[model samples]
Target: MRLDPQKTEFDLGYLGKQSQISVYWNLSSPQLIEQSIINKEANLSPTGALLVSTGEFTGRSPNDKYIVNYQEPSDQEIDWGKVNQPFLPEKFDQLLVKVLSHLESKNIYVQDVLVGSNPQHQRRVRLLTEYAWSALFARDLLIPGIDMYADGPDFTIIQAPTFCADPQIDGTLTKTFIVIDFVKRIVLIGNTQYAGEIKKAVFTIMNRLLPGENVLPMHCSANIGMQGDTALFFGLSGTGKTTLSSDPDRFLIGDDEHGWAQDGVFNFEGGCYAKTINLKKDLEPIIWDASQSFGSVLENVTFDEDTRLLDFTDSSVTENTRAAYALDNVARRVKSGMGGHPDHIFFLSADAFGVLPPIASLSPNQAAYYFLSGYTAKLAGTERGLGCEPQATFSACFGAPFMPLNPVKYANMLREKIFDHHSSVWLVNTGWTGGPYGIGSRIKLPYTRAIISAAIKGILEEAPSEYEPFFGLKIPGIIPGVPSKMLNPVKNWESPDKYAEMAEKLKAKFRKNIDQYKGEIDSELLTLL
Candidate 1:
């Protein structure tokens, strides 16, 4: 298949088709790599492969390999269960059935909740809760929504499909959740809800998978509709994933979570979950204003019902206090809510230790590490908040919770997509500067947002004379319009001694955490610290 280095031919190209998936492992031909192993005192046919996207080509070779050779399953056909224990618990089926009934019975409660709520909040939660439950039942009922693969690994994925735009409703979910039991060589699609629409999407797409052209399931937020190709920003929650990507210059696609189809990137959450702690007007002025309205969900916040004054610093509700608002809340949102191929990708991380540079160019390995690390600091809001103090938190790929179970598995998929799709990846720190965590304030959201804008526009590609190497990125000739002193974390400390103390303190924390997972990581990768 002809590949565009720049994500330009979106909506109308081989990549846009449903058969084109981001594979996680390399493939020999149309069939996946498999092997046999002994388990439970019996020999079984274990899968030695993971899934990946097949790039445009007549035959598979270098450009289209992502499936990883790992342990295969003993089952003859696709049984998602044979892979491992279900993420659910004993009798989870019964428990879930009860919850579904409760939701239906309390449907009136949801409607009542809507009475005092802004229409935006109502719609956002409705979609999230609906999809969550739909996938749950769809999986149980063996419906089209939670189907499995046709030819590779056995697992389920969250997929939203496209349908003829509904003239009545603003937007609607076309494709539901789907499971691809590649081991069975079958794609089980979920279709309980939106049957007419979902069928329109899956059937139209599935029949088109060519020998090498494919669509590997991916879990990342992506958007298109900017000036040219849609630019994608990949990072975990606190890495400014939402803050940095809401560019005013381009049409805003979805935020938070997305399902990447061969055609374009679509959002999972119909809304945004922005950090509300220490939120101010200058940075995210629009989102900032969204805090007090009827639509937002104030997490651990204190407010006056009569006066309408809000203390953004307060966290009385819950640590995960968030402002959940629909993407359409901002007028600049795209209608289809998906973007074309991306031209750039910026991975955000909040490095509290201040040991690494502010920015760095990522080698594919470093990109995988950082992405797996999902680097960021815990903040005042969010369930894991440890107060406003920033601290280094490295998750396997990008601090995403679902990592490690399939760290190498997911990384291979994402890496292949970026490269074959010709997407660029950059590592950026949004944590501390002069002092780590408590000693320093977060890299201002407004300033960080500006830097990201500059970077995405290709301004930082040339590597300038007056650039500072933070980690991998060259902080370009100090981003104008922001305080120059703030750009250099080293100088921002209250005093030299304070800076030294913070660095040592954070270093100790890093060592403690790294040691816990020492066995799993190779010393070579660990030596970078």
Candidate 2:
């Protein structure tokens, strides 16, 4: 098979002989999009956005993920267990050979990119994909500032979505697998075309490598205000990290992964991968407009074939429908993809229990405690097996799937950063209020926005506050443009007794979940729980 005549100097010799594959290296977005259309891999929307549907599996397959338990560094460092499952090196090699063999007769697209926005910590990543659309996705989600001809990649990701592994032979749990061999600095992905896997695999690598360099890799969104005040929003999927940080009033640094270093926070990605399900133009005009722009990659989003228009409300494909576009697509964003140490840090939780106040001021210890707990409700379609109902869950650091180290590592880093920067941390509940998920209504977007705005503007610092004894959160008595009663969850509830019961239940869940990390975290932080 012939290699693309326009190939770069990046070598593929280490991946055994690749004589059977037609390798297309470093194709531009337009070229990749055109290839995708020619190969019948994706369709062009009316707005010129590339629309692709990830068949069968629409979300990440966490159960099938693994990390090679090869010697040294990774073996001793990675907190290997359920989250970071171990895969034998031999098995990885076998799977790699099989995957490469499968790709022999097919076209493979390669992209050379960087992972971090800051040059100091930037990681050269080379992505090899079976589909042209997947290569376009990698280009859209990753920092494309690297010169492929200059140096080889620090890490390589080979994704073959069409190559299904035999669970028995390949040592995979299923046909789908995402295995990371840190020692080899290579990642393997198969059977799943949910583009997010490609994005998050790089994040997982950063999470493992950054901590040692004194950089706290985070699963959060960040923005800067007019006065140059920067704010961070940390939360799990469907908790509004992307939505809240895409504020028109502020300049966005990045929408997903970031690294908080000694100087400031720098984004890990060059783009924003935003959830598009139930997306409203009125509420999230920035993301809405970006999703409708040309060169953006829309994954699993429903559209009218004749009109070529997207229906953001439709969830038949999957609620996890997403839009991937470059950071430039956003009008209000930091061109450098970096922000100063945050003045305010918000831990957003979609508390389906509805017992948490709409907004609560968090002490240092409280912030660390909540950060480690990473309490949030698992919304439907965010992952496989989650039904329509929201289920209360604790994902340490709000990104346990991507975090390879102990939760305490990130928690301690956050505590140190918060104390070092004198940043105010707030627990903002974007979840249901008044009652539980089904019984109570979700908090209004406008009201949540008002509370966040007030906090960022430092309007609620000296506001009259009352302590919530159950969680020990200080609830603000008043917020500009929001009803005072809405700030206090107990007051919004129909039955105070019911709210107390739900609060107690959630408190128990927190204590139980945090117990696993009891010995590692500070006893003082535990007391805040």
Candidate 3:
């Protein structure tokens, strides 16, 4: 591999010249695999994929993430609390020095990559990591470096996973820290070894910056039909966003992270980071095939010692087992990873509470209401602290931690876009039915897929519909392959009284969440509800 010395000349003014850095620039996937093995950082699976364990942290540490309070153009614009916590600029400088100091004599792998498939909004990103596998992970997930030295980077990330922080000195709650200074276009990551951090930090950056430009960034899966119609699936982890989007028939644009711009919907990532827990080849052929590929990275997944076969059922490490692979590996995927304006947008919810209908059509206001509510169960192992059991939660726009602006901003943008594009919105519950979580069996994947197919084919559009009183969602009375009774949650429940009780509890939760966004939300949405 040819080392581009020009790309190495990044302006690391915070890093001193005395630091002896071994820089590996733009290494090919095979070269990176060799380096990882040489450095004892990764083990190759029998399938030839790179397998590595993220020690201690199997998921994202949201509490430790913070953005520097630069008090500039973005200070007031940033929604500053909890998810978007503030870090003093002084503390950031101190920590930056500490991070650079630790990496002074270490071998650092650098990948100058690109984000955003749209040419107009493409962001060149420079990633520096202490681990070769982490660098490869970034390369697998982000757009590869090609003429990146000429393109230049919009943001520079310095990641030192082994470098620990002092809470008392750093003013951080924990030893791990993910500090971002948008003002300086720099990201500092320390202590945490989870690769998901790298993926999400960049997403947070985009979420913060894109709205001001009138771009609606979404944490969803998107695909285009053969006829050029595009569809988007929005949901939290384990809600089948990745699973449903990888349909054998549709052309996948991307599995996650997309932006709805004036021209169309463009992918923000070059790859798909898919949850592999209980993944069966027959169920998810696309992702399953990709996970077994040579360049893909498997995180916290178990494999047999002798056969070296993966055990998707194993959750000893974490249930949030994942596989990261480029989009090209999928059997059917868009070449450019960009799609025309989406004609159908489905809000996916793994309704563990089992009160939501299997599939329902939503009005514009209902779409905005549910979008802001972002109602879904928290999938275990997706975050730093979570279990396999479903936990009901509301994340604004389905990506609260990543959104920098207020929830209403994204909701408003989505409403405007839906109106302008004449998009049809549907609510899909990929969670449970019969009863909540343990009481009921999880919804079958085939059934969910059939329901989704009906929506995508526009069959549900002409179907007879009935109003789901609590949520005010228009439940279709019949779908081609779906059981007529399953279309409405109330009918599936053995006891109507219990169904009503559970539905009321969920409605209360929704009301409580929406109350926080009272003035910002349209009164029409409330009336529809």
- Which numbered prediction scores highest in lDDT against the true structure? 2
Models, CA RMSD each: 18.4, 2.2, 2.2
Q: Candidate 3: misplaced stretches above 4 Å?
A: 1-11, 14-20, 148-152
lDDT of 2 by residue, 271-332 (tens): 89999998999999999999878889999898898988889999998889999998878888
lDDT of each: 0.41, 0.89, 0.88
* Candidate 2 structure lDDT: 0.89
Clash number for model 2? 0
Clashes of each: 85, 0, 0
Candidate 1 regions off by >4 Å? Answer: 1-90, 94-226, 289-301, 307-313, 384-388, 403-405, 463-477, 482-529
Candidate 1 has an lDDT of 0.41
Question: Which ranking of candidates, highest TM-score first?
Answer: 2, 3, 1
Q: Judging by TM-score against the true structure, name the best candidate.
A: 2
Which of candidates 1 and 2 is the stronger one according to lDDT? 2
Clashing residue pairs in candidate 3 are none
